[model samples]
Target chain A: MRDTYQEQLDELASSLAGMCDDVARAMRNATRSLLDADLQLAEQVISEDMKIDDVRASAEHQAFGLLALQAPVATDLRVVIAAIHGAGDIERMGDLALHVAQAARRRHPQSVVPDEIKPYFTEMGTVGVALAEKAGRVIRSRDLEAAVELEADDDAMDDLHKHMFTVLMDSNWTHGVSAAVDVALLARFYERYADHAVAVARRIVYVVTGQMPGPLAV
Target chain B: MRDTYQEQLDELASSLAGMCDDVARAMRNATRSLLDADLQLAEQVISEDMKIDDVRASAEHQAFGLLALQAPVATDLRVVIAAIHGAGDIERMGDLALHVAQAARRRHPQSVVPDEIKPYFTEMGTVGVALAEKAGRVIRSRDLEAAVELEADDDAMDDLHKHMFTVLMDSNWTHGVSAAVDVALLARFYERYADHAVAVARRIVYVVTGQMPGPLAV
Candidate 1:
């Protein structure tokens, strides 16, 4: 019974790490759909988000079962609770990616991102996916160093988001109000995606150190 | 010992309901700050956000203690876990309010909302605070019917959000790209604030029914 319970706990962690991968892939494809105006890819990302939601539900159920039946204490209890909270954060990351995809689909054949701004968004997507992948590694390994590095990577995403704003607000901006609105919101989606990834890393840090990371940098 | 555990559980519920009030007040002040272009009020909302954060930390600690020390099961277990989740949702609501207040501050003296669009933001704020207060009532009373009503109120907020977009996208829109960006982000903040309140109501429903609410309504 003891061995099986321990296995269940470990399995919960693996499930959450898998969720990170799901959101990462969702974000990568969502970004592609946005930049290339690929309606099919955008639709695929939107439809597949349910898979991520199902993973979260199952993981939370597993964590709740561990807490109720196993009555884990101390570090074990923290792990169970962290899994529940971490799953919520990861599921939200999927939703943000879905929003990005929905933005792509809303504009349809007309690409949402302009040519000059495309590089910044491309970098944001790359950084965003990399953050999600690193968050998965942090969950699986419980490597505190990796968690710290993940927060630093989130700063790069923040920079990209800010740069996007600079390009929008510049007097020379020729994209007009509709395109600017789309770009502002798209920037927010990518920035929020990185924020959730950082939040997931913070949960890992809390589980390992018994302390939540210092308040979010921004 | 059993009686003390029960009291702890009851206190946890009160704490979460209190968190709902905190966020309600924050949103009210944030909206006021935004509408009036009052730097002092905006600063107050921004600085006082820490109070909400501290409330979350303490409530989570209380819930965690009950889970670990009491090993509550059945509805008792759900109450503790839901308190944990509810606190998180309420805290995010506070953060969203802070974001709104910050937008007002950034645009200082110059009102963020043009006179024509002020009515939409005003209604959004009123609806947002009502939802938070309703969420608190749902937490205290476990009234599932009230939770359903809260979801409907969110639809009103959604309509307001949609209306704002229409106004911005209209060909007659003359606010320029910067103002459009500001209005877009501010609208998003209020919409998300209502969404979090809805999430808190859903957590209460889950605690009562032993099931998560259906997927969010867009």
Candidate 2:
């Protein structure tokens, strides 16, 4: 019985890590669709989001069952509860990617990102995917080191977001208000995607250490 | 022992409701600060956000204690679990308000919303506060009727959000790129604040009905 319980817990963690993988793919494809003006890729990201949501529901159900039947205590209890929260965060990351894809679709046939700003988004998207992948590994291994590194990675995403805003607000900006609004919102989506990844990593640190991770040095 | 356990569960619900109240006030003040360019109010909203975070941590601890000690099952278990999720949603609402407050502070002495766009923000702020207050009532009463109403209320927020985008994209827009970016993000903050409120209400419905709420009619 105890072995079964332990296996169930491990399965729950794997399910959440699977969610991170889905979000990573979604973020990458969403960014591609935006830069390439590929409606098909955008649509695919939007549709596949349901798969991520399904995983979230299943993970939550598993965690609920563990709490109800197995009555896991101590670190085991924290792990189950963290899974519940982590699932929600990862699901939200999927939603953020969906928003990015929808933005790409909205401006289809016309690339939403201009040439100069493309590099910023490319970097942001790269950072977003890396963070999501790291979050998945951290979830499976309970690696505090990797989790802490995710925080620094998130800072890089934030810097990219700020740079995007600076570009929008520059006196020489010629993209006009509509493009500015789109860029502002798109940058926000990628930044928020990174934030959720960090949130999932922090949850793992909490589960392992039984304490919230403290602030990282710069 | 059962009586004490029941009381703890009730206390958890109350704590969550109290979080709603804090968020409501924060949203209201944040909006006021933005519309009025009141730096002091904006600072207050920013500082008070910590109080809401404190409530979230305490509520989660309370739920965790109940899960570990009482080992609640079925409806009781759902309530405890829902408290964890609902607390997170409510805390996010508070954070959204904080974002609004920060925006107002960043542009202090210069009103972020121009004359023509003020009406949209005013209505969005009103809607945000109403949703937060209603979410509190739904948490305490578990009123499915009230919970459903929040969905509609959130629709109003979305409409306002869409309209703000339209206004920003309009050919007549003269606010320039910087102001457009501010309005875009501020409108998003209010819309998301309402979204979190709807999320909390849905959690209550799930606790009561043991199922997720269905999509609301347009």
Top candidate (lDDT)? 1
lDDT per residue as tens, model 1, A1-218: 99999999999999999999999999999999999999999999999999999999999899889988999988899899889899999999999999999999999999998999999889999999999999999999999999989888988988888888898999999989999999999999999999999989888899999999888854
The number of the candidate with the highest TM-score is 1
Which digits, one per residue and each the tens of the lDDT, describe model 1 over residues B117-178?
88888899999999999999999999999997898999999999998899889989998999
DockQ of 2: 0.63
| Tens-digit lDDT track of model 2 for A33-86 | 999999999999999988888898889999999999998888999999999999
Residue B192 alpha-carbon offset, candidate 2, angstroms: 0.5
lDDT of 2 by residue, B32-132 (tens): 99999999999999999988888989999999899899899999999999999999989889889999999889988899889788888989999999999
> Candidate 2 DockQ category?
medium
Worst 10 contiguous positions by lDDT, candidate 1 chain B? B209-218
| RMSD (CA, Å), each prediction | 0.8, 1.7
Judged by DockQ cut-offs, is candidate 1 incorrect, acceptable, medium or high? medium
